[model samples]
Target: MRSWAEAERAEVGRARLRVSVLVALAIALMIAFVGGIAYVVMVHAQETQVSRELRYNARYGVPGIAPRCAWVFVLEDGTLHEGDLEVPRGFPLRDDIDAVHASRGSIERDVKANGTEYMVLTAPGADGTTVQAVFDLRYQLLDRAHLLLALAIALVAGLLLAALVGLTISRRTVGPWAEALARQRRFVTDASHELRTPIARAHLRAQVLAAGLPADQRTDLDALARSIRGLADVVDDLLASAQLQERRDRVPVDLTDVAEAAVVGETERATERRITVLLDHPGRPVLVGGIETGLRRAADELLANALRHTPEGGRISVSVRTVAGQAELVVADNGDGFHPAEAERLFERSHRGPGEGRFGLGLALVREIVTGHGGTVEAVGRPGAGARFTLRLPLAEAGLPVGGEHMTGACP
Candidate 1:
């Protein structure tokens, strides 16, 4: 648990970091998009210019006087005349020349040879022959390569510069949020802590009175005691929710370990009610980045909720594993299932269902904690069926080395 002052610092630090990262990402994406467009336009223009040069050399140039980096060949009267220059090994594409001569149609294609690309065109000549033109594309290819390298360098520099700019901007942009969080969190934590003792005392006194009263007269007193205890639980949950923003001591924790621990904690309760508690976890760790205490609370809340709703002798299943790159913990119970419509509403603060002796704060607190760890929680259930609660957290970079502690039991 973090003190109010430490929580304030963590919240402010996170706010600034979030703003800085978002700004840097935005600028980096913009740079990449603009660079891509420029690269595309340059490539298109170069291709068009190369095609024009090939056409021009094919039409006007003689065999020996072809343009630089270009060769011209003429086939006339079934005799081939090559340029005086040393022809490339694959010159005068014979197939294209024969095809053009026979069909009297133009054939244009790109060919790669000699470690470079060539733009080749064989067309019917006005002088009763076939003319072939080849243009070496090495220089153009080199230019494009250079452009790509330049863009890569620019992108890297832009990212660094954007990060620096973001850092400078975030200090000012996150000021209001920092102050607001400090003020609000300080009050919530303080008030919740202050009220907890008195509430606990009142609850204890009511319980004693209800225990001593005659059975018929003690009904309302027991209800009052229960309500007071519920109030204490709410206050405790609020305190936990307020403290969840602390980013300190966030380490890679085994989600399987957390889930198993939660299940073990509820085992006594389950057995007392003749309910069976089953835990199924992987042999290896399902690691997630989070404050272990908060993550444990989230797991515990789900299991406790399942136990509370499940009827005596009913079963509860707790599972932890890696799913879709996330560490997932699921708690399911075959007890008093809720209506499907209330699945979403169950997490709303203060929303109470019929016969539910809670203020709907536990699941909400669990959601808040999981969300703070960059995770998600969901509820699924149907009337007369069972309810399932799943919690998912982004997996950490493989788990840190921790002593092996595991539990596994299949649920019937």
Candidate 2:
């Protein structure tokens, strides 16, 4: 239970972190996009306004009477005339003014000097002479810089806010899911616990009645006993499955040993049913990392499933080996098999095949256990051809002798 709680907490923590990161990224991107558009628009408008001011000063204005951040100079009759205005470092742009006067066309260009940008325009002035205008762009550059700084600060704050919001949302969303899971597990556990004693008593009664009945009339009583026993087994399986994920004592387990034990456990029943049970393995230990009891139960379920399905005198093989850094435990039976398409759905909980004759909790629990251990289980078979279940787990150690020793024997 402590382990289950820890695992659930870890799962929720990871989900919340993931949500926070995604939300932060989304908000950051949006802020960046909007800030970029605004910056672009501001710069464009500033440029258009600056150009308009320069043109207007050039067209009709004296040098000292130019608008704010603007300076003008007139070149008429090869003489410069500017009404005592403070000129910038590179004044008048004499080359451009002369070029415009000679070419009789306007010359416009941008220059950067004196720690600021300047836009200059030289065109026809009064009396067909030349006029030069220069606009200072220091205030515009400062405004852009301030905007960028503010956007940076806003982005940082927005990311923090977004992360907080994401965490809150994730907590609220996942809280109910985790609670529902806890409730379901508790219900299964409580239900299974409550049902165990009655099933056991019913099984005991059925067995007693079977024993007391006459040999000729014992057939139905024996069937009833078997049915009750099956019910008890199902209940036990449910309980085990409910408690599977709560187990945290994962250790190195030998797959070969597990297989052999499962086959031995069913030896008596297989012998009684007149089924040929084959136990095949590498003889040596194939190590995997998992809770030993859960793995043992999985192996037992597989072998028992095969044994139960195989007809009298039929064959059931329990094989364990190592392949490609993985331990493969396969159980195959030559008995009443299922359709090829039903292979995947066979592992779903309480999924019964045609006429309600199929595995319920056994295969499903096997899947849950194997998946919890970061392994895989596969099923494949053709109807009337028998079924095969392959459970694979990663090897606890590399180079653990693949197929070093092969042994095959039939269990009595």
Candidate 3:
């Protein structure tokens, strides 16, 4: 049994380790790639410099061509004499050489003689004439070695900085999610406790009503029944919302059919209120991927909310239309609209305005349903002006006829 925090940290650590290893490998490869190229280029440049120096020296010998010079040995054959010139200190000189010979052509090679190394360039001058130029690359080698070391240091520093930045970003990003999870757990606990109380009270009230009381108990029983219903409705809404949030996949829904069903249900309930229902765009079905029950619930909540707020005889209009690959469900009424102060918090769970026994969960449920369907619900109404609730759903498929006869019916 691993603690949640420990498990999360371990997971994060593993992820960070994986990312760091990949980044380190990439950085190492990059450095090696660049360093290998630089080494090759530097070696080539040093060789070029040595060749250029040799050419300059070959043109002018001794002190004028080179600052340091030395004579090592002499050789003779027949009527000519030849000698070897030692390279200056810190300059490359032939360390491996065969016996100096007087011949028609010249030979050049890097040789070690007497434990000293040299780069010797030899060529024929005239008939039986030979010359050699020697140079050392100790200083060039040391400079290249230092440069490679510096580049490696810089590369390591850059990799460390990148790792630090990555770690910081991961921590910052996951912090909010951790806090939200904790809050959600608390909310669930609180909601469960709240649910238990109402249910228990409703059960007690039901038992009392079932005990066969007198007429005096009728009013109390009715109030208890209303409370029980309200509690049940809230519980049902909470469960539905949770299910919607947890939905992993979506399916296409016919908006026109869903709208007709919602309107019909609201109409039945609004019979006592005498709210007029106006249905527009009665010929076409607009299809989109959304939960039918959620959509219908949202629509009903909007219509019922309107009827509740609107005065009797006030015109309540419901319209559905398809436009530009989207379906719009608009519900409006001719009554004083929402107050400015409540506009921002209208869709927040359990927030209500100035009204008796008004639990502010209806609009919140509406918002949840619309959001779960991958759509947007907006309220555009000002104080003293009739409010409009607009639901937008994406239309299904391409070039579908907006006037298909599949959509037909008024709210029940």
Candidate 4:
């Protein structure tokens, strides 16, 4: 399974690839459309110029005026009239002359002979004769071919340029997200490290004071010790969650053992709070491939969250089982639940409920750890009812015996 960072990078790469492809396609299409229109307009203008020159040569009888223009005069009886203009051979044929005479009006057509193209025009002459003019289209056709080649080259270059630009834009857009994630991870690591010294000193000082204090003053010291331990746990969670993002090791870990261990770890806190904490699990192991330490921290976070929310005398249960080839670890608490709409948001960093007395990183850390393991975690509950957090992980193919034991501990 891919780590969280790897998965996020993959998603970003896919998005960038899509954007680049779309941008290049759009640019290529626009270039092709514009080039096509320009080509048509240019070709039409050249053709119009040829036709106008033909008309001018026929009317003015310009001799040797244009090399490619050929004109001949023919009588109404379909007999050719030799004129001053030198007509090219194989042009304005007898058939063409006859067709003009039959029409008895202006006629325009294209003629191809000996692999050469010509635009021909026929009109009635002044003395009851017909005049036919032809213009060569070879140069114009060559010009059009050149235009097509240029357009193709421009299209290819434009697509390449657009692809480069699109890739640059995509990287620029996604760079900040990667940087922010890195900075957050760094902050978590730094903060966790910075907090350890003070937390250890406080814990040691509290222990010394509790040892020296009389029985009457011991209760307050114990409470202080608990609060310090909770802070230390929070610090440890912060560090673990930050490191989990980069953790790539995986092994067959029995979630049952992780869950049972978490419940056993929280027994003292549950007893102090006067809350009933129960652990229910199948006798068999529920194996999953993941970082055992991270999974244990996730289970610990869930149980800690429940212990925090549940009221005195309220019930909290941690259950582990397998369902449909998936390992499920569920933590349910009969506490003052949050608003239904806020269930999803509760897992966001630093998001705390009213009077929850938490920094709100526990659930967020749990979610991060679970997702890094290719698993999912969700919360469900309503105000005045209980809350249930379910975590599901893909189960290993075969159950890996882990400690070969089960925890059925319930603290009163």
Off by over 4 Å in 1: 1-18, 168-173, 189-338, 350-412
Largest lDDT belongs to which candidate?
Answer: 1
Rank list by lDDT: 1, 2, 4, 3
Model 3 TM-score is 0.43
> Which portions of model 4 miss their true places by more than 4 Å?
1-141, 155-248, 265-278, 303-317, 333-362, 379-387, 397-412
Local distance difference test scores for all models = 0.82, 0.81, 0.62, 0.78
Number of backbone collisions per candidate: 0, 0, 13, 0
RMSD of 2: 7.7
Model 4, residue 132: C-alpha shift (Å): 9.6
lDDT at 76 for candidate 4? 49
RMSD of 4: 7.8
* Per-model TM against the reference: 0.56, 0.66, 0.43, 0.58
Model 1: lDDT to the true structure:
0.82
Q: Which lDDT tens digits does candidate 2 get at residues 180-205?
A: 87787779878988887777777778
Q: What does the lDDT come to for candidate 4? A: 0.78
lDDT by residue for model 4 over 1-412, one digit each (tens)? 4544455567778878887888888899999999999999998999889988888866765334545445545554656664665665676556666776777678888888757688887877766677777787888988999999999999989989999988987778777876787787778788887887788788878888999999898987977875676567666655655664654346788888898878877888899989998889998878898766678778988888788778899999999998887899999999988788999999999998877576989889889878877899999998879899999999865554433321111100
Best of the two (1, 2) by TM-score = 2
Writing each residue's lDDT as its tens digit, candidate 3 over 240-314 gives 333313332345567777667667766655667777878786586667765555566677788888888788777
Write the number of the candidate with greater TM-score, choosing between 1 and 4.
Answer: 4
Poorest 10 consecutive residues by lDDT, candidate 4: 403-412
